[model samples]
Target: MMDIIDLKKKAAEIRIRLFQMIHNAKAGHTGGSLSNTDILTVLYYHTMRHNPQEPKWVERDRFIASKGHSVESLWCILADLGYFPKSELETFSQFGTRLIGHPNNKVPGIEMNTGALGHGLPISVGMALAGKRDHKDYRVFCLMGDGEQAEGSIWEAAMSASHYKLDNLVGIIDRNSLQISGNTENVMGLDPLDKKWEAFGWHVVSIDGNDIVSLMETFNSIPYTEGKPTLIIANTVKGKGVSFAENAIGWHHRVPSDEELALAIKELTEQIESLVSKEGQPHE
Candidate 1:
């Protein structure tokens, strides 16, 4: 296992890089991307079994970004992991670039081309079922947005995953409670989120999405029960690290201006320093 300090450092670095990338592109989903950063961080930097050198390595665990507009954070993490060059991110949202605003199979580490809501979980269920049939030990993880739960297809997939008894599949919902329009409850009530998944026959775990320790502990406890898929509802702030954008609906698709970017950098930089100061502290 990698040291918690080192993992945190890598996550902070990815956050900084994504912030810069979005600011430069002036066109990327900011809120969900930021909300889900720590989730991506822990998975890519710590938990996942992936080889950047061989993205197609069949033995590797598969990751699918269901809420794919938040691809900026994933792209940054993948680049840092050496799946692709860091410089490739400079082409994000450019006229001719594979690194578009959503997850694309053209990208080496991306398992599927996903921007359409509610598709990732179903595909991941299939992946898990395939692994089961082939006697592979690899797990399939899919991350979805809570607001996306309003989509009927998502529930359908949930039912399918449970019916298959996909113990190898894990679902994570970025329950930031804010979507592109407004508060998720106001838009489409999904309260008692855990019960909803539980009724679908999944083992559910709720945790603070931004807390690295919480994320690590929760992920380590996966397959919470036998013959069931796991679903983690990660409660989080929409624009997590940025003070000005946190929980604000407009930030969902807004780009940070020069001044706002500087402020966000300052805030995140302070967080980086704080984490460094806790380097020697015992991690849970």
Candidate 2:
């Protein structure tokens, strides 16, 4: 039951840790990971019911990183939660490491092998459907990239989730507006995305994805409408929080230089400090 302030501080810490991981790896998706950090922070720390010690807890809420390229933030969060040794983060992206560039089910916290884009949501629909069949109350959360919306399979899965009345299924789009090639609109044209999801029978909500408070508020009120899947269009800035990289298209998969990494860390550290200063004070 963390307050908004603690959640905000945790998100900053996650951003700092994830940056360190990507910088150490020297080969990782930087922008999307940064963009989705707050969303992950809120789900892991405040909203979702999960167990680091018991990764297979049947009653725990399930999460699928449908937009799996930006796994750096997820890896940091998993390690920080003790799903594995935090020291293993140094081995990320190395040859022969479980911590590769994508989500591998071999990892304790991961539920599926993803990163092919368009596959995660389909798989999540199955998981959600299974939960319903078993009469389980756990929720399934699928985090998708706005750029991934161009995949036809995503629409198929969206229709399936809603058709089954899987109100337990929650889909969050990290609408950062940028992908590997460039702007998503220029690439695949997914504008009016919220309306599109609603058309498929999902209850839709749009919010600033990077805002910790907004993310917390949105996630806390899941399944916004009864008997419908929930879709949150989390509008966000790619490469969020890093001053030089914010909204920069080149950072989609670009590794930061040593100087850039240092500067990013400095900025994130200052953010942590600022949040800490307001810790004991009253929150609005």
Candidate 3:
């Protein structure tokens, strides 16, 4: 059984580590990384079944981060889970570090090398299809950004997933709305996003991406429908934790200064403390 409260605390800590990773490295997609933190947290800490000690376990679930630039959070989660030594994080974005700015397959726990915007979903579809053909029980999950929706290849992959009735594939979109250039709608409108997925034959579920409780419940109801791929539209705020960066466009690829890092650290620390105070308490 997964402890919901611990999951919440883990997410907060991951956010702090994620910020530290970028601050030390002096480069990262800050806004997107923070926006998708909760989703990544829930998936790694609660939903997915895998052995960090045996990352290549044959029956383990596969995860692909399609929106690869915001990989700082994922790296933090993997290290915290013991996929690699925590010390490796200090080498992030340095000369010849496996912990680059995007998801890299060379790093253990990552199923594929992504970040090209539209490639993750298609590759995941193929993985799910292979699992079905092999009679394996593993599921494939892909995390993508809202801005990546502009890629036509995503839809084609969606169509293919549904055509194959890939119920084993689940995808979550961090609908933070802001891209590097600006708001997603302004850069490329993707409103009516749910309808578009439904039309493509996916089982769609919309949820508050930041809420651990809600995300856990949603994942429990996966394969929303039989014979369909599930698509979760996780509405999120860009730069989720730090006040100055939340929903701020400039934070997309901006490194935080020392002062900003102090502020972020303080915010994330408080979040963890707050959760600790509520530990073992009943929620109404």
Better of 1 and 2 by TM-score: 2
lDDT of 2 by residue, 95-167 (tens): 8999999999999999998988899999989999999999999999999999899999999999999899999
Measured by lDDT, the strongest candidate is 3
Candidate 2 minimal-lDDT segment of 10 residues = 1-10
Q: Candidate 3's C-alpha lDDT?
A: 0.92
Order of the predicted models by lDDT, top scorer first: 3, 2, 1
Better of 1 and 3 by TM-score: 3
Name the TM-score of candidate 1.
0.97
lDDT of 3 by residue, 143-230 (tens): 9999999999999999999999999999999999998888889999998999999999999999999988999999988878999999
Query: Which scores higher on lDDT, 2 or 3?
Result: 3
Off by over 4 Å in 1: none
The sequence of per-residue lDDT tens digits that candidate 1 reaches over residues 64-104 is: 99999999999998988898899999999998899999998
In model 2, what lDDT does residue 210 have? Answer: 91
Off by over 4 Å in 3: none
Give Cα-based local distance difference scores for all models.
0.90, 0.91, 0.92
